[model samples]
Target: MQENFEDQESVEIQVGSEENLKIFIVNKTLLREASNYCRRRFALELKYEEEPIILNGFEPLIFEIFLQWISNPAPRITYDPDRLPQEPWLSNAATAWLLGKKLQCSDEFDKYALSQFVQNCAFMTFGPWELIEKEATTGSLSRFSDHWVAWNYRLAGPGRNEYSGLRAARATLTAPVRDPRTFDIEHWYSDCGKYMRPRCLHDPITRLEKLEEAKRPKPIPPAEWGRSTELRRERPQ
Candidate 1:
C-alpha cells in the first residue's frame, strides 16, 4: 500500500520592534517612571489643549500607550549635542531600563511576561499595514476603536503565539486611504479669501498707508486751462 504524503512549509517568523520588545521585556517599572516624567515636562507640546483632545483618528488604545509612554520614556537616541531636538522621547535603552523596573515592581506576572503582553498590544495597536490596491473604504472612529479594544483582549501572554493568527483572521482589515491632495488644494482656494488681499506685494502694509492717504484728500491737480498761464509766468513757453 502506498501512503499519501502532504508537504507543509514551517517558517520561523519575526514581528514588532525588536529593540523596544527586548527593553520592555527586560524591565517595566523603570521605563514607566521615566516615560511618565518626560510626559509631565514636555506634555504641553503634545496636547492641543491642556488635556489631549481626542481627535477623529486618536485611538483609545493609543491613549493607553500614551499613558505607558508617559510613565516610562525611551532614552535619548542622539548623543550629538547640536543635533538633538529641544526635547527627546525617552531613549530605547532608557525605556528598556524602565520596563525592567516596572517588571520588578508589579506582581501581576513575570515582568518579562507582562512586557510581552504590552508589546503585543503595542504591535497590534500601531503596526503598519501592507500595501494593497483596491477601492477606497471609509470607517468611523467607533468602529476602529472597537476593533482595537477587541485586539486588546487577545494579549494573554508573550509565549501564546497569537500575533500571526490574529493578523490572518483580520486579513480583510484594510488600511485607510489618505485624503486626496487635489481636494485639499481646492478647499484651500475656497478659504483663501479669508487670508488674501489685493495689495502691493512689495509692501503688504501699503494697504494701511493707502487707507491713511484716502482719509486725507489728495492735492487737486492744476487745471488744464491754467497750465499755459502758469508755464508763461515760470518761463516764456
Candidate 2:
C-alpha cells in the first residue's frame, strides 16, 4: 500500500518553503476519500500553477501525518514511552484534530480522529502527569488544553479554568472567539450537550478540586531578600 502511493506518484504535492522545499509524490486515489480540502486540491489542474499545492498554516510534519492517516485510518501509535518521543504523539494528534476542524471533515471521520486523539491523551497521562501538564499548559496546541483538563476532570480533576477551550470551540465555527483560554466546559455542556454529550463532562466530578496544586510551578518572588536584610540591619541589628 505504501509502495503504491510512492511508486505510482499520480499526484505531486509541493510542500515546505523555498529553502527546504519538499516534493511528495503521492496517489490521488488514497486522498480522494479522506478530506474535501484534499479532494478539491487534487481536483485542481496542477499544470497551470508554477508551484505545487502550497498549503499554508500547517507544519509539513503535521500535514504528512494527516496524509498518512488518510491513507490508513486510525494511526498506529506505539504507547511505549521509552520508545516513543515525549511530545510528538499528543501535539500531532492535536494538530490533526484542528486540521480536521479546519477542513470540516465528514462527521464520521472527524469523530474517529477525535476519539484517537482522546485515547492518545489517556495513554499519555499514565506515563507522566508532569509531561501531560507541561504540554497542556504550553497553549500552543489549539483546542487541546481544555480537553486535557477535561481528561483530568475524568481521571482526577483540576478546578480552575478547566473547560474553557472546549466551550470556546463549541461557541462558534467562525473566528474571533473571546479568550479561548478561559471558556469552561460547563458552558459547552449547556450549549452543545444535546448534540454531543461528551462523557468526561457528562459524568463529571462536581467538587472544586485542585488535583495537582502541589505539582503546579511556583512563581519566583521579586528581589526582596537583600533589601529586607539591609533594612533590618540599619534599624536594629
TM-score of each predicted structure versus truth: 0.16, 0.45
Candidate 1 global lDDT: 0.29
lDDT of each: 0.29, 0.48
Model 1: per-residue lDDT, tens digit, 49-136? Answer: 4321212222222323433544454322212323322211221211322332322323221222222322232333233211101110
Off by over 4 Å in 1: 1-52, 75-127, 130-237
RMSD of each: 22.3, 19.5
Window of ten residues with lowest summed lDDT in model 2: 176-185
Candidate 2 lDDT score at position 142: 27
Q: For residue 73, give model 1's deviation from the true position in Å.
A: 1.3
Best by lDDT: 2
